[model samples]
Target: MEEKVGQLAQIAGVPYESEQSEITGPVAEMGIPRKLLPIAGSVLGVSGAETVKRIQDNYLKENRLGIPLIFMVDVIHGFKTIFPIPLAIGASWDTDLAEESARIAAKEAAVSGVHVTFSPMVDLVRDPRWGRVMETTGEDKYLNERFAESFVRGYQNNNDYSDPYAIAACVKHFAGYGAPEGGRDYNTVDMSERQLREHYLSGYKAGIDEGAELVMTSFNTVDGIPATANKWLLDDVLRKEWGFDGVIITDWASLGETIPHGVAANEKEAAQKGIDATVDMEMMTFTYSNHLEELVEEGSVDEEQVDQAVLRILKLKNKLGLFENPYRTASVSDEGSIVFSEENRQKALEVAENSMVLLKNEQNTLPLVPNEEKIALIGPFGTDENLLGAWSWRGEPNTASQVLESMRKVVNEDNLLYSKGSNIEEITTEQLEEAVQTAEKADTIVLALGEHWEMSGEAASRTNIKLPDAQLQLIKRLSELKKPIVTVLFNGRPLDLNGIEEYSDAILEAWFPGTEGGEAVTNILFGKANPSGKLPMSFPENVGQVPIYYNRFNTGRPYESAPNDKYVSKYLDSSNYPKYDFGYGLSYSDFELSPVQLSKNEMTPGDEITASVTVTNKGERAGKEVVQLYIRDLVGEVVRPLKELKGFKKIHLEAGESEEVTFTVTEDMLRYYHPDQTFRSDAGEFEVFINNSSHTSHTETIVLTNK
Candidate 1:
């Protein structure tokens, strides 16, 4: 029983020594006995088939029950052949692409001896100031929910545990981690229960419903209770309400963080609170290993509680077939061929091409003709290899293609020019002069700019979310040349483009597109691939509009944009609208959405109303369009959002071709969490809008009457 309890706690990865060293040194540092090292359930941040096999072989010799250690890693984007980050995938608005990316990541990680991946971070994010927004699917609840299900399915592969390519998926930062105060990471998150249920909890629930094997507690406090020990969230909602029986794990060292959160006095009390909340595992924390047994002995926590947690861990291990083969899918033979395979590289390329958002293309500045016009590629990122964003631990930057190398394939050597205008943060007068000299010889300029890859991940928050001043200065100098300029961005978050936007004729938001990033960008620039991705999150005109999103509630006195209007919810210096609204994207081909048509005016219980629209390609080039559907409740017990995305479809069309897109609106779609906390739909008037983006003005209304 003591061994079982010990298995519920995990320790940091032990150093790999050619000659086996005594475990006492490492184990003692974690405040645990040397004997518990073998019984400890799992290890984090360790990979490689040969090393994993050696560690398991040595641990089994000392383990009394021969239970194997589970190897876990943060394979967030990919293992070796990196793909676009989660936020980029969300911009694609293609659930199939999101799922396929996860499948490829799982296959690569499994071959490298990873048993579990802490990924598919389904936190609903609206604030771009949070550095970790780059890790989420973005602001809308419905969109986040759909991507959540796709990611879970991709990692698990229909829950076939014995498949060598499959790895256990752990959905993370459970419950309101994305709504931290002041857009800071690990900050307190306080909101009404109604607000939490309505906006933030849908994505987590979608992942859980799609059969994710584990749930990770968030770092921030939900209400007054830290998520690591919040009983109402973990026990009442996750376990009892959602009927989730999967293992619950804490984020790295989150269990011990209860002390800093002022919830527990010491490690013993933290472990007790964590177990009482039904958390199955503590990652990289001494709370459980140092005090769980003592708590059980003193009857401060029930013995049965420890037993249940242990059983869940055992079940997960057994499900992975670890008992029969501790090194279940680890293979030195497969590692060479599977990790960063050519097939995987091609998949990464396809996703990167689709994930880029075309924010602007004035005067048809893109789709540049090859060899006809002299092209100058200017910036630090022009030949840089740091395209893979943060959280790519195993991804090799050397494998990524540089922009100059990729453009060389399509353009003649004599016609294509290049220059490193400046570093990502600093610019020299000499460097600016050299860049202008290069631009003077070229007919057009491709100015690559954005935040460094490290500027927007965990602990990488910035108060000012804009391009470096140096980059903007370079843009201003090049704009003075009176030559066509197209800006390609390499950022992780939505950047404020107040100054840069006016100078560039066209702008492409190519978020840290991974591995084959350069090749993907080249395809779009040369007209081989059309840009189709939309903004998953809003782009604020300025940093002051930090938490701006499309689904916000209308103020009592809404700003009417009239000359005489005053004293409303309007900023003195800026407008409430975003610089570029969510779901806004441009392609080579223009698309027009017809007025939304409804099957009927009224709906009843168990009856569905079909909302249909026709999308026509109005341009000469073939392209794709994302038809979006939004709903608004005229009246409710609690105020509702002005507009909420309910459904969307991405369709490809030939030039001048038209297609009909339909969405079935059922009673379940209209339901909301009432004041009494029950999920139900109220009898009221509803408004529906079918358009290309969230800022569309066309709409139709419907009514829902009592059965």
Candidate 2:
């Protein structure tokens, strides 16, 4: 322990302090210094088999434990083949593809010598204000649990964590980071024990269940204590209840964040608190490197905790077979060897194309008929880079092809008119004239709108997530144009789109498409691609519905009424409805839900039943329909939601075709968190709805009795 501590982290009084300088600073990283790894040895984001070769040359070549250093990178969505963000992927309910997406991400990231990925961020968030929601699977325990398992299997591939790229999966923010106050990053979290177990802790357990090898401590405090130093969380629930044996790393400089958290006296105190809480690795090392040894020598902390941390790190490395292959798989000559080829590009394009969500198409304004005339593309995001949203590492905006260039390729460059309507945050009139004039020259107008990437990521929280006034005003003005207007939105989180919906003829949510986003947009526009992407989150009409989701609890007065008068959960100012509910999307084709056919009209806690419905493609074209299954526990010991998303399935059908989609309504799917904190189903009458969208649907009823 003494030798290794001095070798890498450079704490004085530890053996082999001479090797400390080898670990250089100015570590190019996505987060703070402790988590910031030296780029000199990192071959990450490097294209090809050369990535593997470089990892061996840079990290494994040292004269130390002879164990290779594990390479870690972000594979949040899909790897080379990017699927929807974890949230969108969850909405897909296509477990096989979601798992395959993870596997492919691991495969691609592994090919580049990455040993681990900071992914499957199982932070169960209820607040949509948290910008990081775009990264999680969603807000349901069962759904998140299912996705968490898929993610682990995708990343780890069985019990073998030693596959070069088959690195360990990290179950993150240890506990309750997702329940941040007011939906802000690093905010305080306060919840009852029952609430914590029922809502937030399930995803962590699910990840652990699927063999997640590491846990990243959250930035927030659970109840009164910081999660980074909470023994009840890290030691008790994580270690005891879930039995997670992997190392726990703090969120970038989280140990140092103790000063702001008002938990520790100084760096030494922070180190002691975190070490006591069972933090296995100090991210960025400001607290640990600066004060760990002092605490150990001063007897403020047990030296055993430090050794325990190192032990976890070593074990993870050994699991990756680093102790076996300490040599670079290839040499510097192999750096550009060959990877990220045409095949990978095609796969990325395919995913991006599939991820496009066609949110609105009024008057059948979409499927733009290819023409020989001019096209107009306007909006700040049309040509600018970096607003594509969050956590895209080393994202180069200038290099990413802009929307204008893409439209030019689809049409004729000479005929494509371009205008930057306004910047993402600011409202302006300067570009309105230019945009209108450009639109005058084109046969069609495709206006891009939405928040800048920073407007929605970590600390990127917002009080008002609406379209900027300038862009909204611009769209209002452009709506008067003779040209058909198609608004392409570049967003991270769901924005309130009532203004745009009223003005734009068609609206396409083009979430900051990654590297090949331009191609995806162009293909979808020209009908070369069909958008099958579904909304992973609810889109509210205004800020008043900030916390609204598909799965919300039923209040004393719920949204049911016989007339226009009385007491209910109805808001005096607005309806208790989202602008677009979760799992809501539109396609060129139309689908109709038939009468639900349950295998039986009755169910008991022990017996299972299947709710089946026939979906018919009423539109002329073949399309994909995500049939949603929502259930309501009519009466329960505790308050229950009016309806909750129990299950959903995306079925593709040919024109005029019908397919029967069925879901097994098991007791687990019917169970709810009770006042006693137990997940048990209650016997009662229930309403089941099988719908095409969240707000619109078909319904049936069933009775549950004791067997």
Candidate 3:
């Protein structure tokens, strides 16, 4: 019984294995028993082969049962050879690249004595103010669902953990961790069950259905009860309804947080609620470790519940092949060869290249001629090496690629002028004058700017999502030069681009491109690579127009339907549109999309149709285009979105090249949760729009018959 309770506990390993374990700060504060360290089921936030092996060896030698400790880390984006942030990866819209990035991350982590990664966030985000939105794919459910499957497949290797390079994929923050109130981290999430099922649940459901081995409960509340202790969320929905039999783990210290959440009276009650909710493991807390044994003995918690949770933990360990080889590939000698390898770095560069979105290119200002144009690269990010954005636990920032150094490799030293316009937050007069002087000496100015690496991950939420005032002042100073200003932004979440967009001639959303970010951005700037990435999340015109997305349900008094009227659902001070729409992007080369052609005008529930369109690359260079398909239910049992993304295809076309893109639409694509909570499609008229963006105008109609 003691061993069973210990298996439910996950503690930080560094303190547990320290020579002064009895006096360590974290361990002593937690009040956890010194004897329980040997029996603890897992370790959190510890990496590297040497350290992990030492800790694992110590636990096994002291334990009576000989159960190996499973190691877990936040390996969110990349392990060592980092890739772009998840939001940037979503902009690429290439699932193949997404899968490859995950595969490489798994390989690197596996060799470092890691067993599971908490990644592929897949949270549906619309509010750019939420710092963790940078960790999500985007606002749309369809795209999130697709990326969820891709990341899970890449991590678990199609759920076959027998592969030496594979690691278990844990889809995180289950049940609306993204939609916190006012875009605050760890805040309450108040929404109806219908809203939860309609928009917030699909990504998690998709990841689970794709064979993700574990699910991490969210830190926020669902239906007013904290998710860590909500039986309706964990047991009723995730376990029974979704049919997920895998292990369920809580977010860091979340089970203990139930006390402040008012759901539990104390640690004992928190443990009782967690067990009743079917929470298999508690991370970074002793709520279960300190009280589970007592609860079971007192009859408040059944012994069978404790046994089931212990069995789940053991099953995950057995599946990881830890029982046979305690060190499943953790080797100090092999780690050097496998982690951050050249092959992995090249893949990171490719993913970075595709992840950048060319937001604005007036008069074809981009794809600059290196020798022809004397370029001035100025801003805080011009020489900054910390491009690996948030959640990069093991990624080295000082060794990462830099913009100024990368530009020197392509352009002559004399052709490229450099200056720091300002620091991230504060600007001095001397710095601003030097930046302006540097821009005056160059033919064209390339301004590098964005939020600091610390501004966009967990616990980093903001009320205003915009470039800092210092950077905006720098842009204002450089814009006065009138020598075409090209802006390159390095941010995690989408920003309010009002001030910068008006002055810049061309804009590239680089999104803190990881290890090879410098080379990747340089490639796009000099035409070595054409920018093909799209906006995964919408860029708001101002902070006031936030919480904006493409697939919103139409209001009875929609601005579009009643423009110029006072009673419409329109902002009085701001426009009702985003500065940039979802799926919107620019390319050096031009591509034209033809009208949508449907196979049939009507169909039954079992029927299917093919929507085809011809996309032509009329420009002088080759480029890739993401052909998007959207469908709108004209009427439904419940309110429907104006248009939902049904399908998408990314195709490459050279100059004068044309390709016929086709998507097969079936009844499954039209399914939704009804008023009665039945998950199915209804017979109705639907409008289909096929274009490169969600802000599409071309439309076709089709009907679904009850017969």
Candidate 4:
């Protein structure tokens, strides 16, 4: 029983030479004895085939049962060949691209001896101040659900983990971690059970439905109960209700955090609560290892529970084929060949290209003529390598191409000029002067601007999401030149562009484009690749308008923008609408959507209705467009969102081409969690909208009758 208990606890990496390294801080801090190392179920933050093999070889010598250690890492977006951040992937609205990125990530990480990846963080985020928003798919439940399934499929490869390139998919931050109050990370999440089931739980359910092998509990509390110890959430809702038989793991040091949350008195109590909650694994914490056995002996916890947890661990190892071959996919030779291969780099480039959102293109200032215009590339990020964003575990920033390098390929050497206009957060007179001189000599200005790479990710929340004062000042100076200014923003989350919008002729939200970020931006600038990405999360005009989204519920007195009306729900000084709505993006080619057409006006149980629209390319070039389908429950037992994204299709067409897009709405698509906690669809009037973006007004109404 003691050995089995040890298998439920995971530890951080211990160095090859313990006396020469401080890598054992987690071990010593947690008071974990050296003897427990062999029985520990897994290790965190350890990678590379040779290093993993050596650690496993040494642990086997002290093994009582000879169970090999499973290695896990935060391979969120990519392991070696980096791709765009998850928010950017959501903007692409391309499930196939999302899945392909995950497949390439799994392939690269598997050769380096990684068994599981803590990725596809399907948290539906609305607040841009939360730095971890970069890790989420965005505010829409339906879009998050689609990307969730795509990521799981990409990582697991249809549940066939026996293949050398496959790795276990761990969907993370389960149950309302994205809705922290005041947009702070690890803060309290206070919401009704109805809101929880209606919005937050959709993505996790989608990933589980797609066969993700593991679920990681969030750090925040849900409905006043800490998630790691919330039996109602982990067991009743996730395991029993959802029929998820896979293993449940706590976030880093989350098991021990139960005491800080005031739920448990000590480590023993925390361990008992976690086990009772059906958490099969404790990560980076010794609470389970130190107290599980004592809890079992004192009748605080069942011995069978310990056995059950260990059995799940062993079964996972068996499913991963780790028992038969400890070094299942670890090959030092294959690691060099597979990690960042040419083909994989190409995939990264494609994703980066498609993930860029063209926010504004005034007077068609882009697709610059190569020899006719002298280009001035200015800003701190012009040559910076922090384009990989956050959680790129194995990605090397220096290997990525720079914007200057890519631009030099298409533009004449004599026609291109460059200068560092300002640092990410600070500006100097001398730097501004040099940038102004460069812009004055050029016919067009390509201003690269954004937050530093460290500004977003875990533990990196911000109070004001806007262009840094220094960068905005530099933009003001460059705008004085009266030249065509095309701003390429390399940011993690949506920023307030209210100040910079007026000065720039074009704006491109190039998110921290991964390894090929430079090439991708250049491709869009030179018309090699058209930008089709949309805003997954809305861009507020100001930070005060955060938590802003297009699908918000209608109020008793919704804002009508009536002249001299102050009683409505709106800000005194600002409009309620966002600067840019969700699903809003522009391509080089124009797209027009005809009014929606419905096959039938009424639907019954098990009946399906088809909503069709004709999309036409109304410009002089070939491009891709994302046709979004949204639904609104006009009348329901409970208040519902004004519009919920239900379906979308990315289609390509040449100039003067048109295509008809049809979406089938079934009874399942209308189902929602009722106020009484039952999942069912109510018979009522529903409105369907077919539009190029969320702000479109084209709609058709349909009725549902109970039969």
Candidate 5:
């Protein structure tokens, strides 16, 4: 591939000695309009297949060194299969489900000619405020490793590109981009080498360990340098330390963002710095065509670098076998056939069924009887087809049924009474009166309201994380109706829901369930499928706890005893406890967890310990429970999280069912990032909890022999 790229470079007649810095502008126009901006050939956005096909036909084919365009998109969660966002999937702790979801996504994405996915974003995010946190698995190296392996397995199936679905996975944000200062998006990240090793970079290593094909650098600068141009991060750490051999893509238009970072004098300089850092792919960003060849001729970018970049790309193309099927999935008919087949919609249903986290149910208010009655479904979002959250590109809003409409599909549509309840953005007196009247005439009210899709992605980050006023007030008003109400929430992050938790009979957290979210919600409501989704981020009571997450080091001055403490990280207005904990979820069926028991409590370095526990379905209905395994590092040189997720298994059982889940604990699963910049676990007493959920982690302590 390198030889091929080299031959192509020679054919282009690019000067071997011209410095990239000396190059000033784009090649003399071939009478093409300078104002016609490029349609993104990479990364998922609104750009359609025809747009990419045009790029392949017009620009790429006529290149001096012809290379076909590789279509890429963000397959962050589940692509078309649309699993819960990475955080929600993380709570499932089901690797098989995670990998299978990715595999389905990869297959569907490939059928559309998308050759690569800027996904399996393995950044270790601890701060909930980072808008992009929804895209990554929760913070913990072991958990991240498990999910990363599943993702790589799903995306890369180790199969040739000719196989129906064979897109390479690109692990993203090369370094500690998740630990931005003040939990602000795109904020500068500064951490000691040891801290970086301990918390953030573990996931990157996990991706590398899984043989990921490509890596995308983060937008934020690590230390002081932008990730796309940081040699220490890209070359010294990623290439030298971990031996990553994949092409590096800049996040969005980060090469140009370097100008904002004040590192580059102009767009050309930023392009040179990024290419000089060996960045091969620029996502949605211009300036590559404007300066790359000129810089190569000026000697700033060596032919070795261009060859290096092209070699990596060609390897991927060859891996995908695009050399033969250049128009893979680009046919107009193929696009028309597989875009949203019934089979795919069923897959979406299965995912939505599994992704719902039953947050709180006071008296099994769920599994609502499929009886014919006057149920007043009152809420601003109840009947909304605005169900499609952010980044939902292809689905037509009217194509799928809304929440109330889906409910009508199962039960008697005539018996189900509906009302607008209130508008999601703002509540008016007329709307309120109509909503209250509807609730007054029903057996129950199903209110659906939450942030719009724009409330949480990119620059849409918010300081206020709660139900929009129109919906909250509507819920309060419906509470006054004295009807049995089930609040179905549609949000991207864990929100403050204490306001209505007491008023509502039940609360269901269904965060942005893709296009078919409404159907999934109704399926669970009508008892067609049980709810098993769980909270992946801590739900702070107020926006004041911006960086809230479940696992964190216990401070020296820990708040103790009283709820209304004056000092020690306590908010004067509210309690420190989050409204919900990480891995927190509820189910119609109840599950009881037994104390964790180790096969051999004490073990030598080479010996393995099997920690096993029993789980019984204490509730009457048959359902699945995610049995969690967590560990606490005792007596460490540096403070460690109160508890870190080590392993989890999702088990299903009938009523009165009991199963023993065994976790094999070896040296690999036991190690943590030490203050010395190496990963190792000091011998001492360890607390192992086999939790029913993240909130209710039941425990047992064991002492090591060497200690």
Candidate 6:
């Protein structure tokens, strides 16, 4: 019983060189039994070939069955060579690049003795106030689902983990984790079952369908029951409905949280609910470790449940090839060559270049002239090398490329002036004056600004989503110089561009472009590479407009179709729309999208209709454009969203070049879960809008019939 229960619980491991040589600190605080450390099924957040080998070697000597400890880490974005955050990856809208980034990340982690990565966080996010929004793809379910599959394929190497370079992928925070109340992390989440099925579950479903080896439960509750203990979600929805035979683990300390969540009275009850809910593993807590053995012996919990959980754990370890060789890819000799290689860094550079979105370019202010222009690079992030953003465990900031250094490679050092405009939080009078003086001498001001790397990961939720007062003041001061300001932002979430946009001539959304961020942004600024990224998440006009997205349902008194003018669903002081809608972006070249052309106006369940659009580059240079296709059911049994993204194609076009892009719309694309819980498309009128962004006036109508 002890061995079975230990396999069902995952505890933190100690570093081989630690002075005490045992799990301490937070683990000690959690009251995990010290005797169970050797028999524990897995270890969390400990890596490196030498350390992993030492821990596993020592554990096997003490264990009876010689079951190896599987190592897991929160390798969300990168292992050593960091890429842009997932939100930035979504902006690129290039699934191939997203896949390549994950492949590179998996190669680095696999060589470091890691078995599983809690990556490709497919939570569909709408509220930027939720600091973890940076960890997701975007608000759209279709976009999230696409990236989810791409990341899984990249991580698992097409789900064939037998290769030494491949590692298992774990899709995380299942079931509406992104829509916490008031955009607060770990807060109570309340929504109808229909809302949950429609908007939230698609990403997780896509990852699971892609053969992800594991799924991590969310911290919040579904229908007022915490997800870790919700039997319907884990057993009925995930197991029975989705047919997910892989392991399901709780988030960090989430199984124990069921007690605080009022679902369980004690650790014993938490253990009972967790196993009954079919959660295969408990992470970072002793709830299952200490109490499960007692529960099974007392006959309160069935022994077969514990045996099934243990079988899943052993199967995963065998899948990782841990039984044949406990140290599968963990080798100190090969670590230096496999991890952080030049080839991997080059891929990081390419991904970063495509991830940055050019938000505003009035009068063609960007793509600055290289040697001819006198440029002033000023701000906290101007010379700061911490562009790796959040969730980078092994990424070294000192090795990162900086904006000032990369700019000097193109322009003469004398032509470029540099200044620390201000700290992230506060600025001195001398600093502001120096920044203005630097800008006065330069022909153009490139202001680099962003939230600190610590500002936006887990537990970093915020109410105000605007730039700090100090950075805003510096923008106000820099505007006094009357120079062309090209603002480069390094934030994680879609921020409220309140005071900065009013002063800047051009704006670039560079969401903490990773290791090669400095060179990538410089290439875009100097016309070496065109900016082709788009906004995956909408930027709100103000913090009050948050929980803002493009695909919202029309209310009975919607502002667009309302009968009464004054009593419509509109904000009193602010506009109901976002400052920048989803899929909104600009590049050096301009591309014009033609009207939607449908093959036929009517189609049956088994029939397919082709929606075609002609995209033409009308500018003088070459560029890439992400042509988006959105559909809307004119009427449904339930209220439908104004529009939902069905498909998109990213195509490259030279000046004066045109491409005819066509998407085949099928009945499966229009299916939805109705009030009766049946998944099917209703026979109705539909509208197809093929454009650059979600906000479009042009559309072509279609009809779905039973025949």
Candidate with best lDDT: 3
What's model 5's lDDT at 14? 13
Please provide, for model 5 over 1-707, each residue's C-alpha lDDT reduced to its tens digit, 9 standing for 90 to 100. 22232212110101101231232234222211132122222323422456556555564443444555566677676554455567667666677877877877777677666777777888887666666666777766667878888888888885445566767888888878777876678889988878777768878778778888888888888779888889888888888778887878777767778988999988689778877787877654555655666777788777777777777777876676666656565555665666566776777667767878887787677878765567777776777766555655454556655788787877786568788877778889998899888777778777787777677655555556777777778888778767788888877666767566777888887777766788888988878888877666677777777677677767766775444556675677776677787777888778887878888777666777888898899888899888888887677767877888887888898988999999877755567767666777677777787786656447776655543
Q: Give each model a TM-score.
A: 0.98, 0.88, 0.99, 0.98, 0.90, 0.98
For each candidate, the alpha-carbon lDDT, in order, equals: 0.90, 0.70, 0.91, 0.90, 0.71, 0.90
Clash count per candidate:
0, 4, 0, 0, 12, 0
Residue 47 C-alpha lDDT in model 6: 82
Worst 10 residues of 5 by lDDT: 8-17
Lowest lDDT block of 10, candidate 4? 15-24
TM for candidate 3 is: 0.99
Each candidate: RMSD: 1.4, 4.4, 1.0, 1.5, 5.2, 1.4
Cα shift from native, residue 335, model 2 (Å): 6.1
Tens-digit lDDT string for candidate 2 (520-578): 78888777776677766677778777777776876665567533766776778887888
Point out the worst 10-residue segment of candidate 6 by lDDT: 12-21
What tens digits encode model 4's per-residue C-alpha lDDT throughout 1-707? 77898789787776432531243665476566665676888888888999889888877776788899899899988999999999999899999999999999999899999999998899888999999999998999999999999999999998897678889999989889999999899999999998998899999999999999999999999989999999999999999999998889999989899999999999888998999999999997788888888888899888988888899889999999988999889989999998999899999999999999999999999878787979999999899998999778689999887899899999888999999999999999999999999999999999999989889999989998988899999999888878999999998998989668999999999998999999999999989999999999999999998889988988887886463678878998887999989999999998998989999999997899999999999999999999999999987788888898999999999998999999999888888888898889989888999998999788989989997
Q: Write the per-residue lDDT of candidate 6 for residues 1-707, one digit (tens) a residue.
A: 88888888787665323532475776568677877776888888888998888888888888899999999998888899899989999999999999999998988888898999998799988999999999999999999999999999999999887778788899989879999999999999888998889889999999999999999999999999999999999999999999998999999999999999999999889989999999999997788887888888899899999888889889999998999999899988778997888898899989989989999999999899987889999999988988998788789998889999998999897789999999998999999999988889999999999899888989999998898999999999889878899999999999999899999999999998899999998999999989999899999999998889999989988897764488999988888999999999899998998888999999999999999999999999999999999999989998889999999999999999999999999999899889997889999999999998888876999999998
**Model 5 regions lying over 4 Å from their true place:** 1-55, 59-61, 78-84, 284-300, 561-569, 705-707
* Error in Å for residue 592 of model 4: 1.4
Local accuracy of candidate 1 as per-residue lDDT tens digits, 283-372: 878788778888888889888898889989999999999999999888998999988999999999999999999999998999899999
Q: In angstroms, give how far residue 665 of model 5 lies from its true place.
A: 1.8
| Candidate 6 stretches greater than 4 Å from native | 15-27, 561-564
